[model samples]
Target chain A: MSADAESRWPAVARDYVQAIADTKLLLGQRYGEWMLKGPNLEDDISGASNGQDEIGQVRQLFRLLEKQGVDRDWLETDREPAEYANAQPLDEEAEAWPTFMVQVALSDRAAWLLLDAIRHEDFTGMVQKMGEDEYFHLEHHDARLETLAVDQPEAVEAALERYFPGILAFIGPATYGAGEDPLVEADFTDRAVAEIRGAFREHYVDLFAGTDVTVPALTDDVPDPDEWDEKRRRSGDGHIDQRVADQLQGVTNREYVIE
Target chain B: MSANTAGTGTAGFSIGPEEDADEFEQELWATVDEVPDPHIPVSLVDMAMIYDIEVDAGEVTVTMTYPCMGCPAYDMIQDDVRAVLRTVRGVTDVTIEVTWDPVWSKDMLTDRAREELRDAGIGL
Candidate 1:
């Protein structure tokens, strides 16, 4: 970052941005791992394309934070698993196709909700461009969701139960509003945490309307702000998957990037 | 300046507005516009990828965006822009800034570009 630009950056800028980028980075990892494992060629292609988009988004987001004094290299490769601000749904690999679908859908929606909120005030133009790419991702998720909910409703429900609470905790308790988050105070996003969470809940109200699955209400317990670590979002020593973190650190082939 | 494929002898593609741009800036456009997009047959300028081009002395700053968010061509496009622009006379430095604002869409395609794409059997 230029010295003048660095001087202009506020102190409370990096956490929210890092949280969104980190979540998308892990979500992208899951997509890449399953790109070829999907049941069909088209599904595999969707996974590959969406996964590539996520990596691109992570780069753009990190570049944004770089202006605020965060080192892109440190943010990408050096952070320990606990230093990551990704949502809990991405803590482990998905063992089943249906489970992966629900997990990805929720995780992607949470990230998008954050992006959509920032689009209103975005000056970098990256946010609006990312929203365009995310539009197709959401479409793909909905179509897969419909089929998965009908074919394996039980698995879908189980996956939803597994992931929804983590997202709630990420958004904080149901009482979240502008007063609770520094993001709102910084004007990085136009919506309060609760409003963003509500927008997320509304996404599933009718997603399974015609399917065998019954969508449940988001009654998950929210994290208490008093004990929360705003930078990491979640309040635990819990870390991301070690295997994934190693891949990021390039314990594998040098050709692979942290994305 | 290298006399490679910087200028493909393509037709006029001077920037639409900003008539006040210096002669060097205008020359920079024609030079950089010659580099074809990796995924498309048309030049970058015709594809509406060149958002802004400003020239101060010999230094040039070009703000551009791509049609797809994840297209790996972004890296190539940056390199190509630099290579082509640097080959231009009086050009000493080149800077490329990628933006996603007003995201690239079919509406941004030039008429000539649309025609070329149509001839290529690529749906817009």
Candidate 2:
């Protein structure tokens, strides 16, 4: 992290953007793991395509953060685990296909919601393009969710219970209803964390309602956001996966790099 | 050189507001148009990927964009752009910059490119 970046952006802007980028980076890493491992050919190809889209979006966000004086290299690597602001759920690998789909569906929607709120002068175009890319991603995930509704309903429900609750906390539950978040006060984001979380919750609730799976009605504050860490933007436990840390280190093609 | 000879008619691809292309500019545009995208069958110019080409004295700068932010072959495309631009005469130095200010859309494709895509079994 550059000292200049710290001074260049308001704390809210820096924290908000970095967390989004970091989470997407980890999500992209998770997607890459499924490139050749998805159950079918279409899933395999879609996984690769979505993975590339995530990385591509990450690249764009990093470029923007770079212009704001954040060191692109540092953002990619060199930060400690706790220093990472990614959603905690991204810290783990999805063990099965349904779990992966559920995780992706939730993560992608959360990302889109945050990105939608953060759109400003220059970001307006990028956010719109991302919406286009995300449309297919969410569609694919929703299709998978419907299929899993019949095939692996239990797994899907478990994933929803496990992951969905943590997202708001990941996105900073501390800012929820605690008056206006600094980002909103600074006009960096159009919506408060509360509005974004509310939309996310409403979307999943309606989506789950349509599914045949008889899961409990989506609950709010499941993990209890009272312990949400303002700085880490999470519930104050866990860290990103080690493999993700290696990726953040940008350690591609070990044989190619000179010692 | 087949691509350049096949279509000397620069119907749609042109720089700035000037629809007219001088002989040298046409050659440079043709040089770029001939370098095929790794994924697509049509030339970059046919695909309308070349946004603008500015030539001043002996130096040239080519500004362009990929269809998506996450194009896996962007490096290859950029390198190919540099190599082809260097081959053109009156180009002493070459600079390439990719921008996302106006994100790429299918609307950016030319009529010829669209036809080629359809022929190649690609949808608009």
Candidate 3:
């Protein structure tokens, strides 16, 4: 950590970093659910590959957090559902390809923007490595959107409407009093929520305009901050589905002690 | 002509066999070509990941591309690159730089690699 980070900033920024790390891990878990179950082999390969990329990024962030004195074991395995700091949308099951696409389009891009904001900060090397992965994620999502627009326009539009509000939480509350949030005070993000929301809306519009799909209107899609837990960065009850948890846990059910 | 002191070698070690510049570079590349991709049987050179190789003053730098952007195998591939290339005589330092522009294409694969892929029933 740099002197600027260690000395001048409030402790909340560390929570923010933790939230970002958790979000990446959760997103990787969600993507892992679709590994070989996507609509086609190309999509299957993409899901598997993207899941690996996100997990790789999580490892990098976790290593950084360890350097900053966070406990690695607790972070990886011991946290309760409520203690998880990922965004609410990720808590939902990816039941359909459209739902997954919405996540890739809205939430992933928003997360990418946040990571990109800190690209030149004290964690430049790690952020740059993660950014390289985000580049491919965004590209793959864009390509998938184009495909869905032609094949399943209605489903895509419905997904956009369903998840756009929850995804808005990615940018945080729409407005903040001057010097109110430590995330901004610490220079961790370049834009406030409103600014990011505006830019994201424009980008979202441009993405679907060329096809028959209709982008969801953001006029009344604001997320309720009262529902949001500032510490956990989530707005809903429940963690991941039970099946998902069991599947994840089964990865290393048995281990041998080496003498 | 000079010792490889930049690495873990002990001090005052005698120099190894000498080679002309082109031959030395080819030797480094050959070493690189032998390191297989963890996910695939083919090597980075076979997968079109290696874009260029440069050698100067016993230091080797490789310019590389990912088979796919955000490849999870990035660190492993890079570590393998260093481990393999370091085995070459007279090499002291190894640096691997990644690039994305003009991105990797299947067309860049060597004939042997292409044959391996074809035999495995993998398509471009």
Candidate 4:
């Protein structure tokens, strides 16, 4: 409502959009890895279905950004890896399926919370449409997580141990009293984040309750954005490192032509 | 057309097929018809995905195809059909043969199946 809040709205929306896109793209890539490797035929089909759903979710978010005057191609392509705010170095080291699943479960839970907040925020008509699609996507992934936890407890436990610590870092810093960025501060409330985190913790506890695995405690030490920036710069120094990009391309079986 | 007529109905129609054979064929067809497509939740018979159901003595053979070659739900439907047929009485063995010939099309769906698709928001 205030001029300061109005000015910050775009940035906050962009951050939220980036977060959603990152989670979708990451999970989409991960699920695609299980295309023919699922435990059974039914599982193989389920994995592909979930992969399609994640890609669909990404497209929905991209459509929302497009309506906000963001160029579709640039939102998807032109941005440098370092400029990807929600992507972190930790994801690269999640080398196994269980590890990847843990990361997906936690990030998806966070995403559902963030999207729920945005759905209620004052926005244009397009945002509401995209929000409804996102609500269904969240439910789909929630069902998937429950199935994996109940049926594949050991795998879920292993993944949780490998990925839970990075979750706190993934939430990024709290923006209280940090110079007003309307998008970050506008319609943002601590209570919403707390509620979202509470829901996440409940699922987390339920999955890990009877297992030998234990997730590390959430930390107050927020990661510095500059550190992530520097890591990206180092990786992009053109040393012919195509590890992550190559891995993603390999899983999709579609070469990254980048045209 | 009389009650004294042998192997003839009251309407003068001849009962060419044996009663036991006719009853077995009917039972076999019903079992195949009852299997539902797991993803679409419609009876395979209504979808016309089932091409033929043949019963030879104690053996039952079902030939079917999916809406498309790459249909993801194809295997699930096949599994359901197999599971349902295994329960049919007097069926000593059941074999499902998936075929693509006479390829499936929207025309294959029964009128009721088309209405079901429309209700589900999947236009014919």
In the range B1-124, model 3's lDDT, one tens digit per residue, is 0110112322332111124447787777778888887877787778777867888898888877665544667787888899888888899999876543334556667788889988888886
Distance (Å) between predicted and true CA of A25, model 4?
A: 1.7
Which pairs of residues clash in candidate 1, taking residues 3 or more apart in a chain or in different chains? none
Q: For residues A98-123, could you state the per-residue lDDT of candidate 1 as single tens digits?
A: 99998898889888877666622233
In model 2, which regions exceed 4 Å deviation?
Answer: A1-9, A36-39, A77-79, A177-179, A210-232, A247-252, A257-259, B1-31, B53-62, B83-97, B115-124
Q: Can you tell me which runs of candidate 3 are displaced by over 4 Å? A: A1-9, A177-181, A210-212, A219-221, A249-259, B1-124
Write the candidate numbers in order of decreasing DockQ: 1, 2, 3, 4
True contacts preserved, each candidate?
A: 0.43, 0.31, 0.02, 0.00
Ranking, lDDT, top scorer first: 1, 2, 3, 4
Model 3 iRMSD vs. native: 14.2
Instruction: Tell me the number of clashing residue pairs for each predicted model.
Output: 0, 0, 0, 4
lDDT of 2 by residue, A1-259 (tens): 2344234557668777777887888878888888888889999898788888999888878877887778866887667777787877787888988888887777877877777777344363567667768888888887878778878878888888778666767655634543666777776677778767766777666666766565444345643667766656677678976666876676675567654
The DockQ-based CAPRI class assigned to model 4 is incorrect
Could you tell me the lDDT of residue A56 within candidate 3?
Answer: 71
Q: 1 or 2, which is superior by TM-score?
A: 1
Q: Model 1 reaches what TM-score against the true structure? A: 0.87
Task: Please give the range of 10 consecutive residues that has the lowest summed lDDT in model 1 chain B.
Answer: B1-10
Candidate 1 residue runs with Cα over 4 Å from true position: A1-9, A119-124, A209-221, A249-251, A255-259, B1-17
Q: What local lDDT does model 3 show for residue A155?
A: 88
Query: How many clashes does the backbone of model 4 have?
Result: 4
lDDT of 2 by residue, B7-62 (tens): 22345545332467677777888889889978979998877678888778878888
